[model samples]
Target: MSREAAAPGLGHNGGPPLEDPDPDAGYRAYVWRRAHRKAWKTPPPEIALRRLARAEELGMSYKAYTLEILERGRYL
Candidate 1:
């Protein structure tokens, strides 16, 4: 059997094919990823240390605590 037939879900490079084949969709995804990453920029060191300590005390991860703050604009 040929390589394509051997791998049912894989593309030419043996990876999953793009779910959305439109070039504009790819560009929009890239932009959304960049903006999402930018939204998670590191806070000032003092604030970051405080948040980390609070997160630990609350038995939560730094990311989870921060995401909560970003979504609700409040501390837990």
Candidate 2:
């Protein structure tokens, strides 16, 4: 059935009923995702130059090094 057709909170639950529009929860999630995206995106030119230098010192291309850090959270 379509999502609109499905019952809200129909699954088995032991806790109290959930809030339909939990504004606080939604806002917290939005802020968390926004910060995560900002952290992953390329930085300003000066910072980027530093990253490039570090990547060169690591003997890897800048793109490869950046993707590695973003994915593995550390150098190999």
Model 1, 1-76: lDDT tens digits are 8986777664466666678577698889999899788869888999999999999999999999999988897878
TM-score, one value per model: 0.52, 0.44
Off by over 4 Å in 2: 2-23, 60-76
Q: Write the per-residue lDDT of candidate 2 for residues 1-76, one digit (tens) a residue.
A: 8986654566646565565766699889999899788877878999789879999998999888878877888755
For model 2, the run of ten residues with the poorest summed lDDT: 5-14
TM-score of 1: 0.52
Which numbered prediction scores highest in TM-score against the true structure?
1
Runs with alpha carbons beyond 4 Å of true place in candidate 1? 1-24
The per-residue C-alpha lDDT of model 2 at residue 36 equals 82
